[model samples]
Target chain A: MSTDTAPAPGAAPPASDERLREVSRVSRLLSRPELGAVVGAVLVWVFFAIVAYDNNFVSWATTAAIFNRAAPLGILAIAVALLMIGGEFDLSIGSIVGFAGMTIMVLSFPSDGGGFGWSLWPAILAALIVALAIGWFNGFLVITTKLPSFIITLATLFIFRGLTIALTRLRTNRTQLGNLDEVEGFALADTLFASQFEIFGARFRVAILWWIGLALVATWVLLRTRQGNWIFGAGGDANAARSVGVPVNKVKIALFMTTAFAGFLVALIQAVQFTGADTLRGFQQEFEAIIAVVVGGTLLTGGYGSAIGALFGALIFAMVQQGIIITGVDGDWFQVFVGTVLVVAVIFNNFVRQKAAQR
Target chain B: MSGNGTPLLEIQNVSKYFGSVIALEDVSAFVRAGEVTCLLGDNGAGKSTLIKVLSGVHKPTKGKYFFDGKEYNFSSPRDALELGIATVYQDLAMIPLMSVWRNFFLGSEPTKGWGPFRSYDSEFAKRTTKEEMAKMGIDIRDPDQTVGTLSGGERQSVAIARAVYFGAKVLILDEPTAALGVKQAGVVLKYILQARNRGIGVIFITHNPHHAYPVADHFVILRRGMVYGDYTKAELPLEQLVQMMAGGADLEVLQHELEQASREGGEEAEALAETAQAIESELDELEEKGND
Candidate 1:
C-alpha cells in the first residue's frame, strides 16, 4: 500500500538545484501580468525625460501638471478596470460624465441664466443621484435581460448624450452652462473638488489626491475582500461561479455602479475647476479610460487585472500627452504615440500571461 | 449497508422537459450519508440533465424532490448550497487565474474583523485549503499557485476538498473523472472515497464503470433519460454493471443478427459470425465466474 501510494508520475520534482530554482523564481516574478505596464511606464518616462530635457519636463512643476491631467482619467480607468475584470463594459461612462456635469451646472446656475438657481450642495447631490440611477439602469438591463453590456450601454451612451444636449437646449437655450463661480456656496464645493495644494514646491490639484485614494482603496478591496473574489469569479466564468453560489450578477451590477460613480466624481471635479459645463465635456472619454485600463495589463476579456497597474497606465498616458508637447513634437504625434503604446502594451501583457501560465 | 440511515437526497419519478424536448424522464435515485451513489450512463443518457436537476440548476417538471426525508424545492444553486448540497462541476468551479486558496474560498469566504473593517482572512483560507487538500493525500506545492497551472486531477481534488471543507452534507460531482487520464481518474476516485468516509453522501456521475466500481456503494444506471437498473454493490458485480452500462441487450441483439447473417453465407458473414461467437463465449465465461 505504501509503495502504491508513492507520488504518481510527473507528480514529484527532481532534486532541486538551488541556483536553477532561484533563476526560475525570478523568471516567474518577471512574468507577472503587471510587469508589462511597469516596463512600459518606465520606458515612456525615461524617453520623455531625456527628449524634453531642455523643457525641464523632469522638474517638479512639469511633473505636477502631468499628474493633474492624468488624475481624472486615472480615476475613471481604475473603475473601468474593475468593471472589465468583472466581465462587462460601459460605453456610456463618458456620456455619464457629460450628463453629470450638465446636471451640476444647470441646477446651480443663477435663475437669470435660466437655471434652477439651486445651491451648490443640492446640485451636487442631484447630479450624483442621476449618475447612480443611470448606472443602476445599465446594470439592471444587463442582468435581467441577459444582454451584453456593450450593446446596452452603447444604446444608453447615445441616449444619455442626446438627453444632455436636448435638456440643456430646451431649458437654457444654449449648449453650455456657465457662471458657476457666482453661485451661492460655490467656494466650499470648489475647495472640495477643485482646490490645489503645494507639495514639494509643486502645485498639485486635489483631484490627484482623489485619484490616488481611489486607487489605493480599489487595490485593497480587490486583493483583500470577499467582494473582490466574487468580482474575479464573475468575470472568469459566470457559470462556474454560479455553481459555487457566487452571486455573479450582483457583483457585476455593483461594478457598473462603481464605474458610474467614478464618472460622476470626474465630472464634478471638471465642472468645479472650469466654473461651467460644456455639452461635450466628456466626449470620447470612455474610449480613453478603456485604453488606459488595457494599457495597465487588464485582460480585455475580463477576470484579470490590477488597480495599481491602472495607475501606472494612467501615468504613462499623462507622460506621453504632456511629453510630446514639451519635447517640441507635433501634437498629432500624440495620437500616434498613444496608438503605438496601446498595441505594444497589449502584446506585452499577452506574452506575460502566457509565460506565467506556462509553469 | 451505507450506514443504514434515511436518504440524504431523493429524487422520485423526476421528469424534466425543455420546451418540446425531453431532457430527463422518470429518473429516480437516492443518496445516503456515508455512501457513494454512482450514476452511470453513456453519452446522451441524460446524465448531465439529471445532475443539473440534483444540483438545483433546474427544477423537475414533474417529480417530488426530497432532502433529509423532507420535500424541498431549490430555485437556484444558491438555495441548494444553503441546504448543505455542494456541487463540484466538471469545470471544477474555479477561476483559472486565481490562486488555489482564492478558488477554494471563492463563494463562501472566511472573513475576519468587524463591520466595515471586516475582510477576507487570507491566512486562514490558505492554511485551510492546504490542510484540506493534504487530508485528501494531495500535497500542494504552494497555495498561492494559480489553479490553471494545476493538472486536471489536481484541480478535481481541489474542488472535492473545497466541497468537503465548506460544510457540505451532500456532494454532487458532474463527470469529475470524464476528462482525466487513467491515473488522474484514480486520484479523483480516491478523493470520492475520502468524501464518503467523512460521512457525506456523494453523487458520483460518470459513464466509466471501471472508475465507478471501486468506490460506489450503490449504482443507478441511466439510459435514454430513465433509470434502467438500480443495485447495491453486493447485488451488482463489476462485470454486470459494465454490461448494463454498455446496453447489454443491444449487444445481444447485434450478436444474434450477425449469427443469422452468417447462415446466408459469404466471407464477410463468416467473419462476423466468428466475432459474434468470440463475444458470446466471453460473456458465458463471465457468467460462469459470476455463478461461482
Candidate 2:
C-alpha cells in the first residue's frame, strides 16, 4: 500500500508491480495464514509418531484420547481465535468456565443438601445465560471504558473467579461440589455432553464432534462471509472500519460473548464427564487457549489469523502434552516444548508473511 | 455545467464553529456534475473542516446544504453516503492485509445464497474489482493480491474506482495528490478528471494549486476559514492560482520582517537572514512558475 514510486502506467510496469507477477505456487502457499501451523503440525505429528510408536501412540485409542483432551481446549481455542481475530482477548473465559460450572452445580443440586434442586436443563440454561451476560459485561467494560480488553478481561478473570469461590462457599460451606451425577437430569445431560461412542474399537467423546464442527463453522464464517471481512477490518483498523460503515463495536461484543459461550460449553463437558464442579476448574485455561491460538498462526496482535490455524495449534499442543506422558518424558519438559514451539511458530508465521509481502 | 444546470452539490453561507474557533465561516461552494471543484487551501485553512461539514462528519453551524437542489441535513456520514455522497479520505479506509476485492467491497460486500449459508461472492467480487480498475485505466493483474501490495497511487485509484462503482454521485477526495510523487499525483489528477467525465461531481481537496490547475473546472480557495476567492478556470489562471494559494504578498512581508531582524547580526540573526534568503528564492521560483 506504500511505495515511494508510482506504478508506471502501461509502457513498462515498475519492478515492484512486475514482482507481483511472479505468483509461484510457493508464494501462493506462503500467503495462507494457516500455512505455518499446518507445516508445524505435520512436523510435530511426524516426530511424535516416530518417537512414541512403541508406546501405542499410533493406535486409534490414543487418537480418541488425544482428541478428547484437545476437544475442550480446541473448542475454546476456536472461539478465542475468532475473538483474537476480531482484535480482543478474553482472560475471563477461564474464570467464566468455573463460574458457569458452579452455576450448574449450585442450581441443580438438591437444596436439602445445600442446593436449589432445580432440574438440570434449567440449571444448564441459566449457566449459559450468566456466561453470556459475563461476556457482555466484559465487552461493555472494554468498549465503554475504552480500556484494552486485556485489562478489562483480566479484571473480570479475578472478579468472576472470586464470585465463584465466595458464592459457592456461602451456599455449600465448601468450595467443591460433588455427586453432580445424582442430579435429576444428569442422565440426559451426561448423554448430551459426555456421551462416548465406539468408533473402530476406540471410544470418542461427543466434545470432539463439537470441536471439529465448530472449527468448520468458524472457518467458513471467517473466510467466506461479509462478517469475516468486517472482522479482519475491525482488527486491522477500527477507525478505518468505522469510516467504511462496518459495525466494529458490535462485532467485538458478539465475539466476547462467543468466547463466554465456549467457556460454558467446556464447563458443561467437564462437569458432566467428571460428575462434579469446583471453584478452581479451568484455571489458566484461558491462557492455554491463547497459547493454542498463537501457535495456530493467529496473530496475537490480531487481524491476521484463522480458526483452522487455531485448531491445528490446539492439536499440536495436545499431542505434545500427551506425547510427553506417553513417551515417559519428564513432565517439566512439556512447558519447555510448548514455549519453544510457540516462539518458533510465530517466527515462522512472520517469515512467511514477510516473504509473501515482498512479492 | 454550473450556471446552466442545478449544481449537484451547493452549500451557501456555510459556517462551522467549534466553540468560537470558527473552523469555517461564511463559506460557499458549488459542485456541478461533469465538473471538478477543487478546494485548495494551506494547512489550518479549514479544508478538512469544510470536507467534514460536507460529508456530515460535522454539521455546519449555519448553512443551506443542497444535494441536487434539495435542501438536506445530514446527521451522519452514512446519510450523506446513502444520498450519493462519498468521501474518500486520505487514509482511504482500507485494510492492508485484505485482498483488493475485499477492501473494494468492504462495507457493501456482495454475497451469494441467503442467511448463514450466504457467502462472499468471490467470483463477482474479483471480476468487478478488475473491471472497475480497468475502467479507471489501471490494469490489475490479480484481485486476490492484498491492497498493501499496490503502490500508493494505485491504492488511491482503487478507492476512487470503488466509490465510482458504488454509485457515488458526488465524490469527495481529501488531499488525493498531497503525498504523491509527480507521476503519482498526475495519476490521481487523471482519475479526478475521469470521475468528472463520468458526470460525478468531484470535490478534490488539496493544498497544491499545481495539482488542481489543469483538471479543476471550479476553484474554491480558502484562507483562514473564509473563501479567499471562488472562480471558474477562465477567471483564474494557473499563475494567479499558485500565487493566491500561497500568501504571495504575505511572503514578501515575512521576508521584510526577517531582513529587519537580521540587522542584529548575531549568529542566530545570520541563520534568520539565510532562512529569509531561502524564502526569497522560493518566492522567485513561484514567480517564475507563475509566468509559465
Candidate 3:
C-alpha cells in the first residue's frame, strides 16, 4: 500500500509526484464516512428548515424531545456500532434488554403489594449480573461454534423472546408489569432515570446524559485504547491480527458481550424508569439500533466505525421521527423514511469508503 | 563466537505426520547465531511443515528440539515467540490499517507506569520504532504512517526489525522474497545479512538457491519429508544444491525424453522436438534457477 520506495536495483526509480502528495490529505479526510454524513446532516437540516413550517419544527420542546427519545437508542447504536466495527453482531441484545429489565423488576419484587425491600444498589447489581451473563453467553457461543453470529444470535433472540413471553404470561397472564405504588421502584425510576435537569430552558432527562456518557466512553475506547485497535484489526483482518497476537477471538467475544450488556442496561433503565415491564418490550428494537449505527457511517461489514458517528446517527433517526410528526405526516410513513435513510446512508457510506480506500 | 558460531537452535530426529501422510521425516538442522541456515526445497518438499514445527504452530510429532542449548516443546505460537523464536511468515503478520509503530509493537506494546493505571506509551513507541528502524538502515520518518502504505520490501524490513527489536534469539523468515520483485527481493536479502550481523540466528526458508547460496552458512535440503543432504558453507556446492532440489533423476529423464523427440524430425516431429526443447530448458533452469 506504501508508494514511497527506491526503484528495484536495476530500474530507474520514478520521481515522487508532488501532486499526489498534495491530494493525499484531502483523500484522507473524505475516507472518514463521517465527513459525508456531516454534509448529509447539514443538507437534511436545511431541507427541514425550509420545508417544515409548523411551530413545533423549530421549538425548544421539540428539540429536547428528539434528544430524549433518541438517548437510549443512541446508546444501543453506539454499542452495536462498536461490535459491527469489530466484525461481529449480537441479535440477542433485544432479548438481553428484556431480560435485564425483567430481572430488575423481579429484584425490586414488591413485598407488601407495593414496596421492594431491596435498595437500588442490589437491584442494579442483580441487573448487571444478568446482563453480563447474557453477554458472556453470546460471546461464548459465537466464539466456540465459529458460526456466523447472525445465526447464533438469531437463535438466541427467539429463545430469549420466547422466555420473556412465557415468564410474563406465567406471572400475570398479561403483557405488561405494573405496581407503580412502590417507593423503591418509584425512586429508582425518578432519580436515576426519569429525573431531569434544565439546560437552555429545555428539560433533558438523565437518560440522555447517560447516553452521551456511553458515546464518549465508546469513542475513547475505540480511539485511545488497545482494545479498540484490536476490534478494528480483528474485523479488518482476523488472521492478520491473530498472527500479530491480538487475541482476535477474545476481542470479538468481548464485543458481543459488551453489546449485550448495553442492551441489558438500556432495558433495566426502561423498566426502572417506567415502573413496569411489557412482554412485547424491546421487540424489533435491534433493527432500529442497527439502522442508527448504519446511519452513523459504521460499516455493516465491520472494520471501521465510530461511537460518535453512531450517536449522530441515532440523532438523525430521532429527528426524523419527531420531524415527521411536526410536519403532520402519518406516523406510519416514519418507517418508509427510515428505510429511505438506511439505503441512502449505506450507499453514501460505501462511496465514501471506496474513495477512502483509493486514497 | 566460535569459528563458525555456536548452534542457537537444533532439531534432531524430527518427524511430522498428518494422518498417514508424512510431511517431514527424520529431518535434522541447526541454526547458529550470526549465521544464516538456509532451508531449501521444492514445492511439496516439507518446508511448510518444518516451519510450522519451528515457529510453534505445530510441535514435531517426534523430535528433540533445542534452543539456546535448552530443550523446548512449545504448545503455541506465543510460547515460541516468548522463547525468542520469531517467524516472519511469507505474508508477514502485519495489520495494514494500523500505523507502523502500532504494527511494530503489535504484541509487545510498551506501556508506561504500572498496574491497573498503566497505559500504552505512544510517544515512546513512535520514537523508538522510528529510531530502531533507522538504525536498521530503514529511513521511516513517520511511525504514524499505516503499514498498508509501504512497499513489499519495506514491509519485510519492518517485520525483520520488529522481530529483532523484540529480542528474537532466532528469526525464521519464510520466503521473505518469494512474492517480491527482483529489486525488492534484493532489499530483503540485504536485511537477512543485517539480521545475521547483529548476532541473530537466522533460519531463512526459501527454495531459491540464488538468494540462499550467498547468505547461507549451512544448507539443508528436504525431499519427500526427508533430508536429501545437509552441507556446511565450506562443503555446500551451489550447483549441486540446485540439482538436488530439481530432482536430479527427474531432470535427467526429462532431458533424455527431449533429445529423443528432437532427433526424430518431421513437421509433427518438430512440434514434439519443440516440446522436448521446452522440457530441456526447464531442466537447464534447474541448474541455476535455485541460485537466480
Candidate 4:
C-alpha cells in the first residue's frame, strides 16, 4: 500500500512528489544474503590474491589448473545450490555419480566379450536415463512418504552403493570397469568430455568452458526466469507458495532431477576423460558439492541463494585445494581446511540471512 | 447488484462443516464489479469459512455458487483463481525472500519465447510491476527488492496490485489490517479503496466495523456460523451496529450488575466497576482500533 494518500478526485496532481524516490531507495537493497555473499567473495578473492602474490604463487598455469579442477565441482555445486535454494538436499549425488559411471561402463562392455565393447552414445544415453530415474525415485519417496531429505538421501546413498557392489560382482567378479576402447560413438563422447582449447596462452579443458556456460545459464534462470522465482517461493514458504498457486512439489522434483543430471554429467566427463570407472568412484562428491553450495551463501534452511555465488564458492574451494599443493602443504590437511571454511561460510551466510529477514 | 454487470461470484445459502462441527450455515454473499462488500464478524464467527467458500479452498456443502452468473463448482483454489477470483490474505500470500517483481508473477508468470523451453520476460515483468505499483499510488524503489524487506503494509499492497494487474475481477482480502500499526493499517485501507476505484469488486473481510463503515457499499454481519444481519450502507446505524456486535442487551445487563455491586461500597465492587469502565473505554476505542 502506498504510504502517501491518494490524490483527491478531480484534483490536480502534486508537482514535487518525492515519496516514490524514498520507496525506490528502500527497495533497492533486496536480498542481504546474496549481497553479503558477493562482498564476501570479493574479500576472499583479495585475501587469496595477497597470499598467492606474496608466496610467488601467481601463475597463469596455476589459474588455469585451478579452474580446470574446479569446473566439474562448480557444475555440481550449481546443481546442489539450486536444490538447497529450493528447500532440499541430495546426499545421494555422490553415489549417483559412481552409479552413472558404472552403468555407462558396464553397458559399454559386450556381455559375451567379457570386456566393455564401448557403444558410447547408447551407453551415455542409458546412463543418463538411469540417473534421472534415480532422481525421480528420490523425489517420489520425498513427496509420497513425507520424509526429511537427509534420511531419504542417506538411505539412497547406501542402497546405490550396495547396488554398485553387487552389480559389479555380477558383471565380471571385479570391482573396476575396463576395456571400452572398441565401443561405437566413443570419439564423439570422448570429445565432449576430454577436449581442450588454448585461451590467453593458457590451456583449458572443454569441461571448464562447459562449467562456465552452465553457470551462466543457471545465473540467468535464478535472476531472470519464472521457474527460478518459483524455486525461491516454494523454498521460502511451501504453504504460502501453494496458497498463492505455486506448484511446490513440482519445483522440488525438478531440482532433484537437476541435481541427479549434474552428477550424471560429471560422471560421464570423468569416464570419457579418464576412460575408466571403479566401484569407489565419486564416493564423496555429494559432500564436496554441498560444501561448495553452502560456502556460496546458500542457506541450509532453503530459499535465498544465487547460482553465481555457488560457482564462486566452488572457485574458492578449488583454489584452496590446488593452492595448497602449489605451496607444498600436505594434501591430507586440505580436508581439515575445507571443514573450517564450511563452518565459517555458514556462519557468515546465516548472519546475512538474519539481516535480510528483518524489516 | 449491478444489473448488467452480473455478479462475478455469488454464493447462495452456503453451508460448511468440519466433521461434526458446523463452520458456516445459510450464508450468502455476492461480488460485482465497481463496489466493495465488507464482511464483519468476531473471531470464530465463520468469516474464514465463508472466505474459503468464495475462494474455493473448500466447496460449500449446501449452496449453489455462480461465477459470471453461471453455476460453478471448484475442486481447488487453482480452479477459483482461473476464474479470476483472487484472495490476498493477511500475510499477503507471497514469498518474502523473493524479489517484488518475481513475487508479482509467481505462478502465472508472463513468459516470452515458445513451447516448453519458453523463457520468462524479466524486463517485461519488472516494467509492468513497477507500472502497476505506481498506478496503485505505491512508490516502491526497485522491483528487484525482496518482498520481505518491504513493510507489512507494502507487502499487502503489492499483493493487491498483483491481483489487479493479473485481471482479478473479484478480490477477497482476509483481515488485511489485522496485524499492522495504525499508519500501516491506513495504508492497506487506502489500497482497498484504490482497488474499489479501479472497478474491481472487493470483499473486505474484517472484525473491525469502522473499517467497513466508510467504504463498504453493503455490510454483512455473521455470528456463530450464521448471518446476524445484512444491510445496505444507508440502512446501517453505527450505534446499533456496535451494540449488536457487543452482544446487544446482554452486555447492558452485565453493566447494571457491576454498577449495583459498586454502590454496595466494597473493594471488589470498585474493582468490578473499574472492569466495567475498561469495557466502556474499549467500546469507545473500537473506532481507533478498527482504523488499524
Candidate 5:
C-alpha cells in the first residue's frame, strides 16, 4: 500500500527480502480471528469469579458442572463453525437431535409393547444413518436448487421436528420415551455416553471428553489438511474454487454431514443420561449453537474462523448460563448477556478481519 | 517442454450460447509450448467465454477441442487439469483468508503417509511454495502470510509459480494485469515471460495492446465474439497490432466524438483534442504502412 514498495514500471524488481516488509509482529497478533473469543472468555470468567466469590462457582464441582453443560453445545459449535466456514448452515440440527433420539428410543422399546426391542448399539447405528441421510439430503437440496441453505434447512427444521413428534406418538402413544437403559447393550452405551468420572477431584460426564476430542479434531482438520483449504475456498468464493478445480460441492456436503453427526452425538449422550427424550427436547438449540459459534469468533458469513475459538465460545456460554445462577443474578437476563456478547464478538471479528486484510 | 513447434492445446470453430445469448462464436486459437500466445480483446469480446471452454468449465455448444494433436472435448475443469492445462483466472481463484502455502497447493495438495494419518505435507508445501516464489523473483519472507496481504503482482506471481511447479504445459492467464497498478502490471508481465522461459505454453489474455505487445509471440484479436485477426510477432508490429485491436476505421469515429466534445471551449478540452489528433495521425501512419 506504500509507494516505496511499488517497483517502477518496466524495471524488473530484484528478489530482495529487505525491500518488502509485509507485516509487523504486533499487527499480526491483532489480526488473529480467535483473539476476541479468547479475550471474551477470560473476561467472562473473571466477571463470574468476582461476582460469585461467596458461592461455589469457584469450586471444582461447579467447574465440572460447567463442563457438563458446555459439552453438548461445544460439540455442536465445532461442527457449526465448520459448516459456517464451508459457507453453509444447518438449521435442522436441533430437530436432528430429537429425531435421532426418538429413533433410538422407539426401536429399543420392549417387543411385547409393539416395539422391536432392538439392541441399543443397533438402534444407535440406525439413528446415525438417518441423521447422516438428513444431512446429505439437506446438502443435496441446497446444491441442486442453488438456494440458500438457510431457507432449505429452515424448511427441514420444521418438517423433521414435526416428524419426531408424529412418529414418536404413533410408536408409543406418547411424545416422550424413557427407560432405554433397560435395553440390551444399554450398559455400554451409558458407560460411553452418560457415565460420570472423577477428574480433578470432581465428577464430570463423559460428554466432556467427546467435546474436547471433537475440538481437537476440528482444529486439526481446519489447519492441517487439504479439506480445510477447500472448505475456505468454497466459502470464500464458490466460483473461484470451482475454476481452480476444487471439489467445492463435496466439501460443503461433507461439512453438512459433519454438523448432523455432531447433533447425533449430543442426542445420544443426552438420551443415555436421562433415559429419554421428548419431541421438543432439542428445540432452540440450533440458535444457541450458532450463538456460541459467533461468540467464539466465527463469522456467520463463513470462510474464516477457528475451532479452538468455538471451544472458548461454548465455554463462555456455559459460564454465563451457570454462573448467573451462582451470582444470584436474574437467570432471565442470561439471554440478554449472551446476546450482548454475540454482537460485540461480531464487531470485533469484523475489525480483526479488516485489520488483517489491511496488513 | 515440447518445444518442437507443435500445438499443445487448440480449439476450432468454438461457439457457446447461453439460451440464445451468443457469448462466443467461431472463435479459434491454439497455443504451443515455449511460446506466448496473446489473445487481445475488449470487454464482452468472448475472451472469458473462450477461457472457460479451454479450462473445461463450460463445454462449447459447438466446436472441436484438441490436445496434442488428439481431438478431445473436456467436460470438467479436472479434465483440463489432467491434460496439463491450467488457468490462472482474473481473480486468481485464491482464498484470501488462507495462507500463501495453502493457496499454492489448494486442490492438488501433496500428502504423506497412509490412511487417517495421511495428512497434507505442510513442511514440504511451505518450503516448496516459498522456494518457487523466490525463483519467480518474489522474496516472500513468510509463506504463512494470508494471500490477501500480498500485492496484486505478488499474487499473480504466486499463481504463475504454482502453475510452473505443477508442470502445466499450457498456462492460460486471464487478465492477470488488469487489476494491478502500472508498476505491478509490469512486474506481472515479467512473470509471464518467466513462465514462458520454463518451456511452458503461455496464453496471455488482455485488453491492453501495450501489455500484450512486449510479451506475446503470436497475437489473436477477438471482437464481437469472433476472431478479427491473427498474426505472428514477425508479421504484426506494435502500431499495426494496436490499429487492428481498435477495429480499423472505428478509431476515426471515436476521434470525431472526442473532437465534438472538445468544443466545450476549455483548456482541458483543448488538451483532449490534441491527444485525439495524435491518435488519428498514428492511425493514418499505420494505414500508409499497410499500403506499402
Candidate 6:
C-alpha cells in the first residue's frame, strides 16, 4: 500500500508570475470604486466646456463660480456618502440646513422683534449644537427601534421642516429671518464662511477650501483608518460585522452626527454669505445631496463609495447648473440633465460592479 | 486524547429553554486540545442550540461551562472571543465584496500609528493574511482579491485560518462543509485536521457521518436535543457510528420487518427483499472490516 500523508502546511506553491499579472490587472481596475465618477465628471465637463465655449464657460471666473457653488453641496455630499457607506441615510439633512440657518438668524438678528440679539459666533455655536442633537436623536431612534434609517429620517425631515417654518413665523412674523448682517461678530463669521479670495484673477469663496479640506479628511478616513473598515463592514453586512466584533451601531450613529455637522456647516456658510436666512433655504437639499453621492459612485444600497467621487459629482452638478445658465438654455432643463446623469451614472456603476466581480 | 488532560472547553449538563419551548435539554460535551470532537446530529437535533450555547449567543438556562479548567459564563459572543473561543458560523461572517485580507482582519484590524493619527497597517494585514491562509494550506493568488471570488471551501478555510490566527484556543465550526461538494468537503476536512494538529480544541458540528468518521477523535451523537451515544474512535467503529447517527435500533427493526415481509413472496416483496439483502451485505462487510 502507498503511504500518502496530508500535504504539509504552507506547502502550496506560490502563484506564478502569469497568474499574478492577471490578478493585478483585474484588481487594479476594480480597486477604485470612484473610477466611474471620474469618467462621468470628465465627460460632463468636456460636454459642457464644448457646448458653452462661446459663452466663456471655460474661463477662470466661471470655473471659480462652479467651485463656489459646488462647495456647500460637496460638503453635504461627503457626509451623505459617509452615511451611505456606513449603511444609513439622513433625509433630515435638508431640514437641518434650514433649521440651523434660522437658529443663527433669530439668535443673532439684532432686532427687537422677538430676537435674542446674540453675537454671530455664539449663535452659530448654538445652531451647531442643535443640529448635533437632532442627529443624535435620529441615530438613537433608528438604532433603538431597529427601523430603517430611510423611514426614520423621512419622518424627521417633515418634523424638522415644520419646526423651522413654525419657529421662523413665530419669531419674525414672516417666513424669513433677516438683519443678520447687523449682528455683532458678523464680520468675523463672514471672514471664515463667506470670505472671497482672488486666484489667477478669479474670485473664489472660502467655502471651496473647506470643501476640499473636508473631502481630503473624508478620503483619508475611508481608505486609511480602522473606523473606515467598520463603516464598510456595517454597510456591507452589519450582522457579519458585529459577529467579527465591529461596533456597527456606534459607527452608524457617528455617521449620522457627522452628516448633521456637515449640514450645520453649510447653513453657517449660506447664512453668512446671504446676510439672511429663509425658511426654504435648504429645500430639497437632502435629495440633491443623495443624488450627488450616487453620482459620485456610492451605492444606494451602501457599503461601496468614495468621497473623492462625491466631490466630482458635486462639481458635475455645479457645472451643469451654471453651464446651462451660461449657454442661455432654459434653466428648468437643469433638473432634466440631473435626472439623465443619475440614470446614466447608475448604469455605469452597475457595469463597473459587474466587471469588478468578474474575477 | 481526551483523558490525557482536562478538556480545553467543557459544557456540563447544558440546557437551553426558549420561553416555553425546550430547544436543548441536558446536553454535555467536552473538547480537548489536539483533538477533534465531532458533534454528529441531523436537522432539528439541537445541534444549533448546542453551538449557540458554546459560542455564547445564548446563556444556558442550566449548566456550567468551563474553559481552561475554570468555570465561567459568557455574556456575549464578544466575551467568548476575548476568552479565545471563536465560532465560524456556516455563513462565515465574511463580506463578499471586501478583499480577502480585509475580510481576514475585519473587526480586529492592526493599527500602526499613535492616537488620533492611527491608520490601518495594510502591509501587516496583507502579509499576515497570506501567511495565516498558507498555514491552512491555502495559497491565495492575491490578498486584494475579494472573498466572494474564492470557492466555498476556500472561504471556509479563510474563516478557519482567521480564527486560529486570532488566538482561538477552542474553535467551533458550524456545518462548514454542508454546501461543499465531495472534493471541497475533503479540503475542509483536511483543514480541520490541520487546526487540530496545532493543538486547538475543535468542536466540529455536522450531520454527515462520513465526513466525521475519518477525522474525529471523539464522536458525540446528538438526537432530538439529547445525547444518544458518545464514544472514542478506538471504541466505536465507523459502521456503528453510522448506525447510531441514523437511529440505531429503529433502523434495525425496520430492516427486520422488511425481511419478514419479503418472506410472504410477491413481486413487490421480492424487490423489498433484494433491497434488504443488499443493505444486510453492506452492513456485514462493514462489520467484517471493523472486526479486522
DockQ of each: 0.34, 0.31, 0.20, 0.34, 0.31, 0.34
Q: Cα deviation of B33 in candidate 4 (Å)?
A: 2.9
- Worst 10-residue lDDT window for candidate 2 chain B reads B283-292
What is the TM-score of each predicted model, taking all chains together?
A: 0.89, 0.90, 0.87, 0.85, 0.89, 0.90
lDDT of 4 by residue, B97-166 (tens): 7889888888877777766557777766776777788899897877767787888889899999988987
Give lDDT tens digits, candidate 3, residues A110-200. Answer: 5543325465568768878877877788888988999998999999999988887777556545566665436354664578766788888
Report the CAPRI category for model 6. acceptable
lDDT, candidate 3, at A282: 83
CA shift of A87, model 5, Å: 1.0
Worst 10 residues of 2 chain A by lDDT: A1-10
Q: Model 4 chain B, poorest ten-residue lDDT window?
A: B283-292
Writing each residue's lDDT as its tens digit, candidate 1 over B228-286 gives 99999889987798889878898678757867877666787767557645544544453
Instruction: List candidate 2 stretches off by more than 4 Å.
Output: A1-26, B1-3, B252-292
lDDT per residue (tens digit) for residues A160-238 in model 1 = 9999999998989999888789888889988998999998999999999999999999988998888999998898888
Better by DockQ, candidate 5 or 1: 1
Pairs clashing in candidate 4?
A1-B157, A23-B141, A24-B141, A109-A116, A109-A117, A118-A183
In the range A1-359, model 6's lDDT, one tens digit per residue, is: 11112233564454464566555654676657787888888898899889999999889999998999899999999999999988898999999999999999888875677778888889999999999999989999999999999999999999999999998888878887766788888888889999999999999999999999999999999878889988998988898889999998889889999999999999999999999989998899998899889988898887889999899989888988989989999988889989999999989988887877774
After TM-score superposition, what is the CA distance of residue A239 in candidate 1 from its true location, in Å?
1.3
Cα TM-score of candidate 1: 0.89
Model 5 lDDT per residue over A1-359, tens place = 11012223454433456745766788887777778888888888888888887897788988998999999999999999999988899999999999998888889988676567898999999999999999999999999999999999999999999999998887778887888878889899988999999978999999999999999999888877778878888887787777767889998889999999998998899999999778887898999899888887787777788898888899989998999877788889988988998888888778777877766
Instruction: Tell me how many residue pairs clash in candidate 4.
Output: 6
* Predicted candidate 3 versus true structure: per-residue lDDT over B65-156, tens digit per residue: 99888899999999988888999987756777777887887656666555644556666667677767876778784576678888889999
